[model samples]
Target: MRELRILVATAEAERLRGVLVMAAAQVALGGQATVFLQLDAVGLLRPPIEAPRDGAHQAAGLPSLAMVIDEALGSGVAILACQSGLALCGMSAEDLPAGVEVGGPIGFLQQTDDDARLLFA
Candidate 1:
């Protein structure tokens, strides 16, 4: 199976929606996709709220984002929240969504393995 890895660093809500949409697309195409939500991107996993910035759409308003995240999780997308991000935000493992894995260096290493496709957004 093809492995797809994505690194997202944006905290803006619109980008998060796009990221989720793309991830879902890859999963739908039958490729194994992993999303590493780092930096401020981990904010995407927070309870749905207003857009993080002006002119940005809320991920909650766009059902595709949550749906894709759920789909990716069910299909083994390996969604990860950066450890530093959690600490920086004063969040813990319990703050994340069900099935979302918490990791930092080690998880990132896995994505760099051969046969994996990587994308940074």
Candidate 2:
């Protein structure tokens, strides 16, 4: 079976959560998934209670954004936050959640090009 790798880049907080849900779905179906937090999306790397932005919806019994992120992490989803993204937000490496790599565009490019798919939200 072909591996499914996803590169999700979104600046909007709400949209970023939605993309994460989608990514989790892909993984549920036996696909490998990775998320690249770009621009404002990098703010989400903080712990859920300390998250910078909160636009996630909990209506219709859907899991909250934090829940989905937890699911992704538990499922072994790779999370990358752009190094420049942290700088742009006036944040440091310590501000991010544990295990989130601080890699930029060049690294993202190489990972996605190796038989992986790219999706932007």
Candidate 3:
């Protein structure tokens, strides 16, 4: 199975939720998946995650964004927060959730196989 490499560069809740869902789905299908969080997207991972549409999702019987993130992490989806993104957000590595990794784009790309599917959101 081809790997999925997703670049989550936005702070938008809906987009982030979609990216997480895709990554989680990829892993559930037995493919490797990585989500690289950069720019303002890094701020979304901080504890007590607040998404404006979280309530709507729950009301519609879908998992909230926070729940989706936790599900992605639990399902072997690799999540990397760019080091510079952390600095940009004034967040330290310790500020991220336990399963998230801290690294840069170059490192994230280097780990991707030639056959990996790359996505930007």
Candidate 4:
């Protein structure tokens, strides 16, 4: 399967939403997709808030952040939060949502070792 990997470095709602939409689209097309959240992007891996919590910042016509994440995961997208990011944000692995992996250097290397297309979001 084709693999598409995205490196997320921001926590801005719109930016996060955009990248996730892209990743989820790839998954829907029968391709493998991954999102590696680093730095501020790790914020996306935090526990889900109530419905529409992030809907305000969502792009027009795109799914809510939570919905997009769920769809992507169901479609075999690997969502990862960087270990350094978690520490930097003072969050533990327990703070992350289910199905999200706490990744380190080695894990990052392995995930991108494939001929995956990389996008920085």
> Best candidate, lDDT-wise?
3
State the C-alpha lDDT per candidate: 0.72, 0.70, 0.90, 0.76
**Model 1: ten consecutive residues of lowest lDDT:** 51-60
Ten contiguous residues minimizing lDDT sum, candidate 3: 45-54
Q: Is candidate 2 or candidate 4 better by lDDT?
A: 4
Superposition error at 60 for model 3 (Å) = 1.1
Could you tell me every candidate's TM-score relative to the true structure?
A: 0.77, 0.79, 0.96, 0.81
Could you say which candidate leads in TM-score? Answer: 3
Winner on lDDT between 1 and 2 is: 1
Ranking by lDDT: 3, 4, 1, 2
Per-residue lDDT of 1-121 in model 4, one digit per residue for the tens? 6688888888776676678788878888888788888877786666753334465645556567777777777777788898998988889999987788888756776768647887887
**Candidate 2 Cα misplacement greater than 4 A, ranges:** 1-9, 46-56
- What's model 4's lDDT at 69? 75
TM-score of 2: 0.79
lDDT value, candidate 2, whole model: 0.70
Which parts of model 3 are misplaced by more than 4 Å?
A: none
Tens digits of per-residue lDDT for model 2 on 2-81?
45555556556567677777677777888877888876678666554332344334545666666767777787778788
CA shift at 66, candidate 2, in angstroms? 1.9
lDDT of 1: 0.72
In model 4, the runs with Cα more than 4 Å from the true position are 48-62
- Can you write out model 1's per-residue Cα lDDT over 1-121, one digit (the tens) per residue? 5677888887766676676677767777887777788967787777653353423334335454565567667766678899888887777788888898888857686657888878888
Collision count for each candidate, in order: 0, 0, 0, 0
Alpha-carbon RMSD of each model? 3.4, 2.9, 0.9, 2.9
How far is 42's C-alpha from truth in model 4 (Å)? 0.6
Q: Model 3: how far is 88 from its true place, Å?
A: 0.6
